[model samples]
Target: MRADACRNLDTLLQTGAKVLARDPSASITQIAAEAGLDRRTVYRRFATREALLVALFEAKLDEAERVLDEARLTEAPIAVALHRYVEGIVPVSRQWPLDFSSLESPDHVTEKRRQQLRARLSAFVDRGVDEGFFRADVPRTWVRKLLDDLVKLAAHSNPEMEPPKAADLVVEILLRGAGKQ
Candidate 1:
């Protein structure tokens, strides 16, 4: 694409992220209008709400890597690092209502991005096992799958409106299943 077109695309994506961050209900036209473009132009780049959202999700994941780095990886506990997995997931969850689970299988590129994150978690889980933090028998792959399922649940649930008991339910599940034995 031409340099000016590239700039316009970037502007559209930035404007869309801003609009969604503030209000996920913000329409594509609103995003286009905010970016000084037409709805057709916006869809030209994005194709669909899910596509635009996946783009935003990928952007958020990149930001999460920065956050994890800032958290100082080597110094942090394995559980804390594991929490970073959720830390990054929540933004993606917030950006689009069903962000975590709505992820389509065809989106190989983004799926690989998530797999990279899970790989990191797998390594961390292995470390936790060595240090006696996590259970030796708890398979990292299964834990990754479980966390993915849990984030899908957490995406739409209201932990604050609900009792603290609800939030602890998830932690308890993880603890019992992952705690050192």
Candidate 2:
């Protein structure tokens, strides 16, 4: 409710995400210590580890939604928008790295957000088709799938390849396949 309280909650969530990412078995007390907040504060915000995990999941999605908005997926030129989206999403995918088979199921609100994100991305691909950037002969769904996989690949940045370079490579491959032109 208050500014300081909101900040504390955000810190707890952010630190909890990093800590849990590194060690999934991390405890609430550990999260609070890492976040520099009192254990009671974390307990007040989240009654249990599952509750904290659910909050982390929602926080991850919330951040991703913001990144997508910043990408200007619909308004920008397809090439520029694709580049922005890839660059923006790489860190997010790396940080959150959602496990579709996770034990914790997403709540309805999170599921709806996922659907909304997918629809936005699908629309972007359709726009690309309309503008002749992508092959019109290919199904929009296929194109969207291709883009999703490529972005994921880019997100798994290799030690030899920096994230931006990896993202650029993905964009190039998406535009022009591996085969000789």
Candidate 3:
């Protein structure tokens, strides 16, 4: 694709995420107008609304995979890995707010990637427990869920906060509970 086409696609995807996040029922025409692109352009690229959503989700997943790779969860020290993952993911979550659970029918590749990411995360939590970064007494699933929830909350609740700041807040909250120390 040419530079202009790539730029236009990025604009459409970004604008689609924002508009659809605000209103799931938002129309393609509205998204195109918001993106400053012609509706026909979006139609040319995506055959339907569902196609646009699938592309958006795929873009999000691609970013997530990159973040996970950069974090080096298996090799990095537990604290460092946690912070890096949170910092990297907060922006991606904010940019593409769609929830995978809401997907009507995820392709096999997407589902496989999601499973791989989840397995890696679960393993990281197990490692944290074994390494004493997390208490062994706590359920591993609980810890994983808490971390996921904290990241989502940080991204959505504090939209004004920068990713690093939001990450710091999330890491602090996860490592040390809200209770007075």
Each prediction's TM-score against the native? 0.58, 0.76, 0.92
- Candidate 2 contains a number of clashing pairs equal to 0
- Residues 1-181, candidate 1: write the lDDT tens digits: 9998888877877777777766777778898999899899878888888787788667756765665565444568865655654555554554443344544443778778867765665666567778887677778667656666666566446534232333345445776787775
Listed per candidate, the RMSD to the true structure in angstroms reads 6.2, 3.4, 2.2
Model 2 has an lDDT value of: 0.79
Candidate 3 residue lDDT tens string, 20-127: 888888889999999999999999999988788888888988999899998999999988998999999999999999877545677777778888888998999998
Segments of candidate 1 deviating more than 4 angstroms: 1-37, 44-54, 70-74, 84-88, 96-112, 159-172
Ranking by TM-score: 3, 2, 1
Candidate 3: RMSD to truth: 2.2
Give the alpha-carbon lDDT of every model.
0.65, 0.79, 0.89
Rank candidates, lDDT, best first. Answer: 3, 2, 1
Candidate 3: list runs displaced more than 4 Å: 178-181
**Angstrom error at residue 49, model 1:** 7.2
Residue-level error in angstroms, candidate 2, position 117: 1.0
